[model samples]
Target: MEVVKELKVPIDYLFDVFEQSIQSDILAQTGKKLNENEFTGFEYVKDFSKGNQATIQIEKYERNRAYYYSTHTDKNKISVRYDVHSLDEETSKLHYSEEIISNGFLQKMNDALVGLVWGFLKKKRFKEMLNQIEQSYTE
Candidate 1:
């Protein structure tokens, strides 16, 4: 299953929110915590090094993008990549996409379930994130 979402926010402020929200100890402000039965939590595992594959769990953010590795209790790992586009110094667009590979049956099921769940969850998260960005900067 592939999920995509986009949001418009201030470039600098949005990056700041991205940095803060993905902190190791910070639960996603969106509050979409994974079930402990499926996955206990996430952690920053690896990053873009000299020449190697990057890990998903965002340990720390430097430039504009953050990667997070979500691990399941069964040891399944998936990468969630966040791409930020600066429309202007004060405005930016955030695009997030995730690819979940599963069996044909499970994939179909995921597609159906995710349609209902992801839309609600992703939109809610994006709105709250934009609000936080605006608040962080305006105040």
Candidate 2:
């Protein structure tokens, strides 16, 4: 999945907001602290509901420009990337993409069917979150 959006905030601000969000989420989920200065190649395990867990790795980290990561689970490997471009002094473009690879035939089939049903909802929610971020920054 891929999404692109124009944000009403500078690239630096957007990147900082995104980094803080990720750090807080990781800390909440895994009880781990992330050092922003050494974010690249950082790895941690995050626990989910129902005792599920996944290993998350920071694959690429470029301040104010790009952040890419991968999550490895027993059933799937998921990669996500966020790229930010400055359009002007107070505007930026954000490009987001996500890919998932299933480890087995059944999981692949299930993922396809579930993605067909839930993909739009997920995208909508993500866009809403971005909008909220922009609104907060602008205010």
Candidate 3:
């Protein structure tokens, strides 16, 4: 599943929100208490390093692109990739792609159903995020 959001703010601001959301998710999902650079399971690879973990790893990130992966196992996995495009100094386009894979006949069906629900919820969260971004900048 892919969703595109055009923001009135600059690409830099979008990336700021994106990074914060992912970092927050990492802490939430892992259920571990640690600093940003410290993690019990999550590892961040920035420029030259390669990701080898099977679950919860930042595949890569640069100024305008970021790819993230999280999986319970080979049977259940999801990847979200972000590619940011600048329309001007104050406008940007965000391209997001999400892939959810589940093994077993029953699991696949269940994942599909869950994905459907999550898609709507994801959109709502995005709206809140954008609004929050605007509010934060305004204050």
Candidate 4:
């Protein structure tokens, strides 16, 4: 389950907007929709690290950075890695690939379906989040 999306904004304002988006409550809302009760944050630390025990939390956001995190699946203990890459200063690409531990056709199908639904939700949520950020600049 690999989902990718790209968004373009002004190069000069991109970092500012991106930083604000990450620090804002909008990210928390997105996290709630993406992860579960067990892991619901944008950053994982040494003390709070879930290790390789199947976490569903987002990684820390470095300045002008990209990150990947493995999080528990919504249905099972299976975990998936969400990878993102910041392209240029104005564009960014996101990839949410569902990691399949089991090599079964059924498992693949399940993961694909989950990815589809998650992808749809992500696009909607990201668009809404961006809109909110833009609105804030005006206010």
Identify the candidate with maximal lDDT: 2
Please list the C-alpha lDDT of all candidates, in the order they appear.
0.51, 0.90, 0.67, 0.49
lDDT of 1 at 51: 46
lDDT of 1 by residue, 37-67 (tens): 3222344334335644323444334345544
Clashing pairs in 3: none
Measured against the true structure, the TM-scores of the candidates, in listed sequence, are 0.51, 0.94, 0.67, 0.39
Per-residue lDDT tens digits of candidate 3, residues 1-139? Answer: 7778877778787777766766677656565454434432455422223634445666656655554555545566777677778899887787877787787889999888877888789877867877677677656
For model 3, give the 10-residue run with minimal summed lDDT. Answer: 39-48
Error of 2 at 34 (Å): 3.1
lDDT at position 59, candidate 1 = 32
Candidate 2 has an lDDT of: 0.90
> Which model is ahead, 1 or 4, in terms of lDDT?
1
Local lDDT at 50 for model 4: 57
**In candidate 2, which residue ranges exceed 4 Å CA deviation?**
29-32
Best by TM-score: 2
Clash number by candidate, in order: 4, 0, 0, 2
| Model 1: ten consecutive residues of lowest lDDT | 35-44
Model 3 ranges off by over 4 Å: 21-54
State residue 91's C-alpha deviation in candidate 2, in Å: 0.6
